[model samples]
Target: MSVRMLSRFRAITHYMKLPDDYEDSQGLQFRKEDLNQREVNQIFGGAHLPAPMANKLLRILHGRRVAGTLNDPNLQVNTAQFSASDQRKALAYLRANIPVDEVINAGLRAEDELKLLEREEDGEQKPVETSPQDLPPDTATNEIPIPTGRLPRRRESDSPYGVSPLDRIRAHNIAKREAEEKRLEEERKKREEEEALGNIGTLQTQQEKPKKLSPMMQKMVERATSDLKEPPEMKAWERLLPQAIMTVLIFAGCAAYAIVYTPPKRSERLWPDIPPAAATCLALVGINLTVWVSWRLPPLWALLNRYFIVVAATPRPFQLIGAIFSHQNFSHAMLNMVGLWFFGTRLHDEIGRGNFLAIYFASGALGFMSSLARLVLTDGLIYTTLGASGAVYGVIAAFFWLHRYDEFKLLGYPPDPMSGPQGLAFIGLILGLHILPLFSKKAHNIDIPSHLGGILAGVVGADLVKKHMDERARVRAERLKTMGTLEGVVQVKEKGPEKAPQTAAGR
Candidate 1:
């Protein structure tokens, strides 16, 4: 088998080995996770722990939970981000703050609980896991009966677990909340079903009392909703595939158009009757301008930003396309439009409108995809990027490639057109300005990846077009060579060999 086939086989096996969703002994479905930072962080934060403590704990958990080592009995989970002395100091602080008897009793209780767990895991008495503070003080003694199992969540309201008035009041509040949560879950399911059945509008029209949520309940709801979501990296992979598909689809579209469609003959046009190349440029500018104007409409701002901007945090693959013709402000929109009109028209006139658009859309999509890939690799997935600079760069690069030796004007010219070498130097200067800033330690909003990708696409696109054109020219020349002996036709002499003169060629 080939190396690619072997790699694919290995990937399939790896995915097959990944832990899947399964039901526990209680018939409750549990999704086994290799790692989910958001789920971990949410659960940790929901526990009312200090942010610093939760963060530190997470670092330690992550340090020990290496990807391939998961479920490996040999891999001990003892290492932490904190050094030995720091951990020692922390333990000492805890010891100083907590009572000695309480600590000793807690340790004893914890040890007994672990012993019970081991026995239960080995098919002996089922063990119960309990926090030391939650149990009675007598639980530390040998005479205290070992717990058989854990208390089930969604407990009975009337179950007696506390005695004091304050405790009773608290339990009552918790019971009320549990009931409310159950009701909300049912409502959510019903809403989902209604929406799926296309009856959501009717359902929404029905009068229903608004449910009031306490701050605690609101936090609970937020945590619950986000808890089951897959990891950002996983979702990122899902989004990446669509963007890749879109890029390839665009490329195919461009290729198909170039292969089949022929442009109409070029003709001079009067004012308002724009040339094909000019029309194409104007249409692109109009698209950018329309999106830019939408930025001003407050109602559509959220929708536009979400759909138009390429956000790393919540990436939408289609945004890569939307973002190409999207500009946030007037200055940015105008700058890109001017660049498009200047270089785009030149390239468009040289290439047909279809081929020009092929280069434009394909370059832009590929450019953003390249940038997103780099960002994901570096864990800078929270970033955002937008604009047509990448597509514009592509146009510039193609134009530069086509007109390499063409002399052009420059800033305050000394009555002489800039030489080919001068133009080359000027192009390098602009690219260098963008490239040099990336080396600095400071954070920059500039998108180096899109620019580089665009330039590359342009250069490659130009080379391919040149190659195709040359092939066609060669084929046509061959065809002309094969067409011989046409009456009243003059034959051009070959460069290499001289043919014998034909006296009666006109007959």
Candidate 2:
């Protein structure tokens, strides 16, 4: 496409989208519009109500406060004073009678009333003026009377300042009206803005100034904020069913396939024969590699990040499986794939491919489940886990468990085999490396707990595989023994206690 066409296409896309400020009242049924503590204070102070009505309302508020269904000790619910707790409760319960708009109007009245009272007070405080005509009859004795009382205020015309008192009062009234009009105009604008944006809370929020609260009141207010936090109503078990079901299928399918299907003798091929354990390992490595590579692409990273990592806080059970096959870093992927190739193929060759896959997938799934349990128990759901280290650990641990008795050479065939004790020491060293990092605060990124869970799963998988093999071996031996006895019995019957058959030459 040409640049102009592309730009036009972008504009169309932008216009097609709903604006960011658009909102719907879909949740209006569950939504609440409550008066905050400051709005409730206006009612208590009776700024807008008559003296009798304000007193009655206050008494009613106090009565309702003491009788509320939920009592918080921190709020001092029993106190006679209008405690902060009372204010909180009053705001919550009295929102019906004293809505936010009513409070705002009361504030509007308050400003005007206060301005008039201030003008009157200033008039009273001014020094009284004595007109020359009001002078007492010049004391018969020519001594001017020393004024003992306040004199009358100077008339507007007699005032030393050029401005008349009526003009000043007119200006003050005009200023007061202008301020009131400005307030009304601002509120009108806010209402219009709210209508355009579809936010009903805008008018109240802009009109009311949240009072600076004392520390105790601050704590009480914070405590009340829990009302905003939705309760934990999610059905986690439903979300987790996919992971549990898949893990079970892995183990069950392994058992069923290994026992029920029998490969014909000398039928082995690249097509028919079950691939070596390396096949499963390499397949898994490829999956992880594809995920890792995809993550590097700018267009796909967002998709990978959203779906691949199993975040404990989010209900994304399928991510439990995705996370096992995901790796974002090259070094992490290489190390895990290397470990799998080294140990997994050997383990697979001994155990059938079915059992090998069972160990790998089941271990990784259970490893994440184990980590999930830890996060929930310790309240650490904020952590997100993604990698194949857990599966790799399970493969390594299973290999070690099955070959516990065998001497192993780590470096070269010429090197001395690390016998039983030496092997145990090496395993211990590796385990310690995983376990030690957990105590340090800086090593939070390392998922040592998941590795430990995988190790446990590997040991269990190894034991089960061994028992299955032993049981299959016993059944085969019993069948062979029965066949041998039957063949002998058949030969005797064919002879019929005599020379039933002639020599081969006679025939």
Candidate 3:
């Protein structure tokens, strides 16, 4: 026999001896001597028979021959004769060796194959024998028959325990290879399913093949994908660069304008003549001393500083500034100081010392100006005002503008006093507290015009501060967005190869 045929024959022989219950068989179904030349030729004719097919054929021969059918040339192969166990084993055997399409084409029934294998393995085949004359005409050559008992035993060296070690190794390797292929196929299918589900649009992958990404391109794609999922955080450079640039530009522009433009002849100093804080303290001290002296001496303040009181008769222009500092009694000074303390600290912190002082004095000046205007327009009357009520009202208005969204409540009557209609109600409530005194039998002096002027100044100041801060925040937000977008673009460019592969895949 050729080497290929010899290998195939050896494989069959090896499988036949694999079952350990060979001794329990009732007897041989057909001895090797029963196979005529024609049957032997049929068994060996197929070249490169897979090991599984060869094993199945061997089992079939043993089964038919032992059933006393060795001489019948006209008997058709009856697949139903194989039991359920035999069919399953046969089909499994075929599946391992061939593609699923070929296994189906081969018409191997797993159920029936398994049954035959099981029955034959149980040593259930009955013995059957025939003389040479009983064989078909072509197979009945009158040669002397060899008895079943005379069959040759496999040599100990030919196989270890009647099975070749080399065949076991080959079978093991084939099984491992098939298992690996199955695993890879399963993984490929799972990946496709996941990709299909992830896509929002119609899946277009049926006709398109995926092009593998090159290493550099793959890294780019990975980075871009990550960026798309999670926005990159703002780095220190991103946060500070715009602010620095803007600040530099502002300073440079201011310096250029200052250099280019000359001012008109000075009417007064640009800054306050005295530091605002120091000026305010001295004014308060002077007022307190005046009150003390007036109470003790009685006639000193009335004669010398009568013009300090803001009234139509003694209304000196300078008294607008001076009257702000003076007080008729301690109670008047104390009340104005309380208002200053409440609004001054916060305005100073928010706008800086320079801006705070500017707002304080500017609001106070505007307040008194409004009062002066009102006094000039009114009919002849004596309306004396000697407190910082108008300037304090300006501070309160600034607080309202800055904290418009803040909640305010009053007397537990209406909640959210600063919102919608409730805000209007609160305004009316405040106006009633201040204005109703004008009609009272003995009304205390209240500077309504100064309060109105202060409110206007405070609103303008708060808006300016808010506008400046908001612009800074807006610029920072824009810078962050631009940096993130640019970073994505840079990463993509660095991974140029990745885009090419993805483009190819899309195509």
Residues 312-388 of candidate 2 have per-residue lDDT tens digits of: 65536566678888988899999999999988888888987777777787678778877766765566656778888
Q: 1-507 in candidate 3: lDDT tens per residue?
A: 556433222211222222322211122222222344444344445333444444544444343332323233433233334444544554454335322332221122232235446755887652232333334455467464322211122232444466477865675466446555766898688778767776322444633546777887676455433122332344434433443354334334433442344323334534356544444445545564565455444334443254455654335555656665556677767777777766666665565444454455556656766665565456323456666766666666676667666555546535553334333344345557766775778844577777777667666766765776588689999999999999999998999987898999999
Candidate 3 residue 438 Cα shift, in angstroms, is: 5.1
Q: TM-scores of the models, in the given order?
A: 0.48, 0.48, 0.33
Regions more than 4 Å wrong, model 1: 1-239, 264-272, 411-423, 477-507
Give candidate 1's whole-model lDDT. Answer: 0.61
How do the residues 1-507 of candidate 1 rate in per-residue lDDT, one tens digit apiece?
A: 655433221211111121222111111111222224454345433434444553454333222221222222332223233345444443343335322233222333344456666766888633233423235557456353322122212222444762455754575466446545766898889989878766674546453434777887676455434242433556556757777787788778877876676766445333246778898898899899999888776556667766788876667767888999898878877988999999899899887776788778777887898888777767777677899988998888877876666666656554555433544555676679778887889987878899888887777787677777788889998877766544224444352234333534634
Q: Ten consecutive residues with minimal summed lDDT in candidate 3?
A: 146-155
Global fold similarity of model 3 (TM-score) = 0.33
Q: Which candidate would rank higher by lDDT, 1 or 3?
A: 1
Better of 2 and 3 by TM-score: 2
Name the regions of candidate 2 deviating beyond 4 angstroms. 1-275, 298-303, 412-426, 497-507
Q: Tell me the deviation in Å of residue 493 in model 3.
A: 15
> Model 3 misses residue 223 by how many Å?
87
Worst window of 10 by summed lDDT in candidate 2: 22-31
User: Between candidates 2 and 3, which one is better according to lDDT?
Assistant: 2
Candidate 1: residue 341 lDDT (0-100): 98
